[model samples]
Target: MHTIASWRRLLAEFLGTALLVTAVVGSGIMASRLSPNDVGLQLLENSVATAFALSALILTFGPISGAHFNPVVSAADWFLGRRTGTGLPGRDLAGYAAAQTTGAIAGSVLANLMFDLAPVTFASKERSAGNLWLGEIVATAGLLLLIFALGRSGRAAVAPAAVGAYIGAAYWFTSSTSFANPAVTIGRAFTDTFAGIAPASVPGFVIAQLAGLLIGVGLLLAFYPDAGRSADDIVVAHPIDQAAHRP
Candidate 1:
């Protein structure tokens, strides 16, 4: 693969992240306004739609951008030895986070304006602590493990689909509906849109995700000795995590 510049990668990151968050938040707003009773089904619908769209977009753009789209996922990728170049540069990581964050904010804000779902300062809100914590742990662990398993298997080629699939399932499996990315979590805070987490609650979710991702990446590495090595050094494809092999 020809090495694309940081600028191109950043553009891809911004657009991809924006698209994912917009669809999620936008769908949420629509669902809420449409029917309170169908909200449960709406959540599932939005998650699946987002996941499938993300999978396709990521696959289409992964070659140019690494398709991180999420700051938490990018940080995990950093620890797991995945990057276009050595580390994608510390500066680039900061840029990617900034772009992802900005895009998510724009996504939420746009959705709010489009749908009239702006959050009022005085509005009573629920952030769901117990469910959110469980979500953070489950979402983070699943994301990191998917990356690890895919990468070690030499399936970096299919990261988009694998990642999207993991996320799609996470919404169903976890509570709090899986705010898997810090950027998305923060972005969603500005809106009362669908899938939005209260601004006051963002910190806990981020901490949980970071902790889970860090530990999960390490655990993922231990699944295979050679698998942990740089992709340049490995030849095998699609190695499964031994942890996943356990009952």
Candidate 2:
């Protein structure tokens, strides 16, 4: 288990989230420009870049903060932790969420600057639709399921590849292109690029994601009732105490 300081954990979350969003928005912009006439190509490029970046980031920071770059993931961790007294406390959960939100915004601004776009433009691309909302629900539920299931089972060592692979696959399968993360959804809104979601569309997407989270949790508890019984019970090990176990 990690015994790192609180400040360091928060820093890891912030930096990791920022970099993830940066890759998301930056790649979207580049893909759009490079394949202006091919929407499929644009999505292909963006999804590939995001998958690779996310895998690398998770592996790099998982030992420090569990690499929870999304609010839903943090919240889920806190919820599950409460069950066995091994997850984050309320205060830490709030901190992680706040840091993720802030980092996401900063990452969007950074992506804009990198692409020579306005640093604070609000996205105008509206992505509201019943089908898309359903996609969000499916996307987020699958994500949480994968995460907690990996923890419940004894396969956390494969999380980086597994999670990244799932996200990559979800990108192609979901109608909303799987903006399964609330923070990333918000961050993408800061840029009016191909990957951007209009600010107006943010609330609905977030709600759907949350709803999905709840369903995922319910499913996890039902299927893996003994999962996450304690920090030690987790096979993969959350970053909460990964450092403590390090040699």
Candidate 3:
């Protein structure tokens, strides 16, 4: 594969993550408006929009950055591929995380402004509960498991649709609606709309996501001991070279 420039990959990550959060927060706000009295209907609308948008974004940006809009996904790619020298390096991981996080916040603010709301109103939806935390753990772990497993099995081509479907299903199956990405969790804290999480709830959610990351690593290793061999392919394969992978 031809090597892509580091700047291009970083730009892809930034833009991809921003658009994803935009779809999520914007759809949530629209759903609430369209179904003011029907919470179930609103959730359905939100989840469907999120699922479709996620798949499309992955397809759009996967070639440039592997479409890893989530911090945990990027971190897992680094950790799993560290020993094999095939996954993202520490520096690029940091860059990806920073870009993804900032993009998420920007996306949240954009969503708010598009809806005639404040640019950075701190969210007020408190989601600090034991069950919700557990849900995050489950959701995050399952997501990583699916992503790495597909790469390991040479089935990465379906990752975009599969990941989207998993997240959409998780919205109903998990108590916390599957805020599996740390960057996204932080961004959602910036808005008080239907898709937002309380700023106070951010720490707990982040902790749970980290815990989920560890569990996901464990599960991936257990199921596919050599999964690290495909680390560079996590989420999806791109054309990043070792030089671009470096910090």
Candidate 4:
């Protein structure tokens, strides 16, 4: 039985993820449609637009939902003590994965119609095997670390921008095209837009992202020491610092 707040948080996740996939997949579809000479300029345009839209979207919905949009991120948050209440145990991730998959499919369906997307195509499989796996690892790790730094430090106010900026940057630098998001990647499978990953590849991507998340968790413990976790968090910092410096 979920408390009211927890249920709201869950619904928020659903809504936020749907919106996120819409922007990402929709942009991909539109870009591909404009050019028939392969994914040349289209991919470049797709990358830039996606980075901006995703950054804004996360910023908009992050506060209300933590804007997870990906299961691995939530798991890391759980371990970091940022997420409360019960989470799906390891064996029960199927239910959570199902929820994410369903949400992603619904989102992609809506975007397809809204953008008038064309028939799906498995074109330009841009990533290499080694690069693909490594991209997932680094991308997820970057996103988690960015989230944890801003969130756990009580600086959650800037979380949306911080998260968005990170994804945007990863898009440019990361080889696997930053499929840091498990939900978005799954949602993308149903569409043959500029943004889609081959449906067959989803499982491998998820595994890599999860491994990256675990590695991030390990690093988080080392980077952010517990002994220094102050009560001032954000809540207690503001007025105290003002008072301390007061003459």
Best prediction by TM-score = 3
Tens digits of lDDT, candidate 3, 177-209? 999999999999999999999999999999999
For each candidate, give its TM-score against the true structure. Answer: 0.83, 0.93, 0.95, 0.77
lDDT of 2 by residue, 197-244 (tens): 999999999999999999988988899776556433222354445555
- Stretches of candidate 3 off by over 4 Å are 240-247
Which regions of candidate 4 deviate over 4 angstroms?
Answer: 1-4, 35-40, 82-98, 118-128, 227-247
Give the per-residue lDDT digits (tens) of candidate 4, residues 1-247: 1222444446656776777777778777777777657776776767777667766756655544445667786666445543333322343244445555667776777777787655343423434387789989999888777766665577756666666667767777888879887887788877766677777788788888888988887877788754124211211121222333557
On lDDT, the leading prediction is: 3
**Backbone clashes in each candidate structure, one number apiece?**
4, 6, 1, 0
Against the true structure, candidate 2 has what lDDT? Answer: 0.85
Cα lDDT, all candidates: 0.70, 0.85, 0.92, 0.64
* Candidates in order: C-alpha RMSD to true structure: 8.1, 2.5, 2.9, 7.3
- From the highest lDDT down, the ranking of the candidates is 3, 2, 1, 4
In candidate 2, the residue pairs with backbone N, CA or C atoms under 3 Å apart (3 or more residues apart, or in different chains) clash, namely: 1-241, 1-242, 2-241, 2-242, 2-243, 81-87
Over 76-135, each residue of candidate 1 has an lDDT whose tens digit, in order, gives: 555445444433445566888998998888777777777765533211246758667877
RMSD of 3: 2.9
